[model samples]
Target: MTDAPRPRALGRKSIRPSLVPRDLMGDEELAGVWTAQVITLLPQAFPGVLGESLTGRALQEGVWALRTIDLREFGEGRHRNVDDTPAGGGAGMVLRADIGAKAMAEAVSRARGDVPRLLLSPRGRRFDQAMARDLARRDGVILFCGRFEGVDERLIEQFGLAEVSLGDFVLTGGEIAAQALLDATVRLMPRVLGNHHSAEEESFSSGLLEYPQYTKPAVWEGRAIPEVLLSGHHAKITAWRQAEAERLTKERRPDLWRDHLAKLGRPEEDREL
Candidate 1:
């Protein structure tokens, strides 16, 4: 007869020896748990907002894991310098290729499975809900948080890192962007959000912005909850939500509206309404 599957272990995984102190480590690694490995100079900046609310709860429960690899630990010399003056006489310093490679090697060694390695940069592909959903479906992710003028081009090419941007703007560093990316991706993981439907109904899940939401005190000030929502008619409520989602998308995000229309095989000009 076939043997029964082995039961998974309970509780946090054991601490692995590292230059990073045990206490500063955000969460203990857990077997089979989805993990985010961040390679950053600011190791202490992690689990910032991620350590609260539903994501935090899920983290403590081992539904997901976070590990920050201190990039400075891989630096060279007595001062532990990770960056150097740019080669072409630029105003800012660039993270040394060697230092980045060392840190990435350490991160890669601890990686569990087919984790997508990403580098946060202003010039990279714009991050969005679709990318977050794609990441949520993966085993985990490895994020290289860039600082200063960014890392050596050779290192980026060497690691084959996919560069991602939070928006069209720039940041002092990638730590914030990394956190934002992680927050968006982690919430989509199973059991991370209290309600599964929350992810399904939220903005961008359907290629359009989410419909407006309202709660109790049915009538507030001068406005009342839309009658259709209060009517308890599921069909009408769904229709109303769809219409609002489309209308909002068309008004605020014409780019998204055009894409949505294209998907429906409708003319982009038909977005007017």
Candidate 2:
């Protein structure tokens, strides 16, 4: 019998070097790339939503990078099987510990400096905007997209992989969450969004939902833009936005409102919504 084709990918490869077509990006465009290394069963899902709008443009400009390490490449035996029946028996196969560890090792070996490794799972810590901001400041990120019954617990413990969740719910796979997390981080990278202030004013940047915005065609369908916004007075506009943000947070997300109040050192009596 012929040996399995080694399941492709073989090992982690730098995608930034070839992200943009050679003719599309010049030498200077490749410098200071913020790399993201992904280990997944499905490599093609990447740059999915990320390959549009600002993130797409940034990828072409080399503001950041993406590389995929196909997990099957590290599978055992000629057939390249990466999962197996649960040790104690269960509903579905679990990704083999040895296989996961090998894939992670191979990916990390090719990475430079101290890059953070994350595994997307339902049981992990809740991913939030603050976490995205912290990650944006890092040199790069390595993400492992779990599938099936989930990865072996030992692999997570041994590799020090920080499991993270997009929210309380689960996903069919981590590819979408990976795209989301990357989009959140990449947009905050230098020169990615062009306007730094835009990132600051976005939701959760200030522990509150962003204020409502209105634009040209100030009057639309019998509704007018807020008078404060049209007033052309910066101070009043700023005050209005702040108050609106606070009110929305209080009404929609009491948890965030409480946290915001605590941060302000305001007494509980003053924290009434």
Candidate 3:
């Protein structure tokens, strides 16, 4: 008997490295990937560990590009500071609109195509897998990372910044969120992760949470792998995993599972959950 051949990727690899032929990208034409430019009061604050991990590897390999702009570079007056007290009397300092605006404009001038400008803010649309996939297809992006209280709202409005939020929680600054957005997005770019299937099978890939995964050790601390997984029948194993994934989602994140069901056009089922 022959071993099962590796499952062929439906078409070309998600990421056909530029070194490869251009015709391979299918009709998608992965000609220009999105470049990210983060505008912040402290540019050095960026490319932190977030940039060093898998995301950093993507940058190094030219899967994507990142640029950080210090808003102070465009500050007015002798001090070169880029923030000021809020006009309406806020708790902390607010980043000046003029400075941020100028910096973002400069970043815009440096990049190509219609870029989606994002302002990491508490008042924006919550970021999620759908947002990540959407951003990955764009040509470029400019992330405005607010410091102190926040950036001048007028600048965000005038620049048409799409206010994006990571969650309801607050953070010290938007730089962290920007980095997170970058990391999530770069991974979606073709070829960033060598195993393309990993992306397709991971949580949120199929609009459903990922099924649990296990490794070589059959037992650890007396905890054994599930009996079904140990069963040699391939069909039974796949069915068990799908059932388990659905059950886990129903138990842990019923809301997500509900949405998934809706997407699947399933009849609504009332649950005490």
What would the TM-scores of all predictions be? Answer: 0.90, 0.87, 0.83
Error of model 2, residue 219, in angstroms: 1.3
Pairs that clash in candidate 1: none
Per-residue lDDT of 1-273 in model 1, one digit per residue for the tens?
Answer: 997565444344643335654342454567777889999999889788988898777776567888998998988899999999999797999999999999899888888877999999999999999999899988899999999999899999999999999999999999999999999999998878888999999899999999999999999998998999999999999999999999999999988998888899887476364
lDDT, each prediction? 0.87, 0.83, 0.77
Task: Sort the predicted structures by TM-score, highest score first.
Answer: 1, 2, 3
Clashes of 3: 1
Candidate 3 regions with alpha-carbon error over 4 angstroms: 1-33, 270-272
- For model 3, the run of ten residues with the poorest summed lDDT: 22-31
Top model number, lDDT: 1
lDDT (tens digit, per residue) of candidate 2 on 1-29: 99644422212323344344732222232
Off by over 4 Å in 1: 1-28, 268-273
Q: What is the lDDT of residue 267 in candidate 1?
A: 72
Task: Tell me how far candidate 2 lies from the true structure as C-alpha RMSD in angstroms.
Answer: 9.2
lDDT of 1 at 1: 100
Clashing pairs in 2: none
The C-alpha RMSD in Å for every predicted model, in order, reads 5.5, 9.2, 8.0
Residue 38 CA displacement from its true place in model 1, Å: 0.5
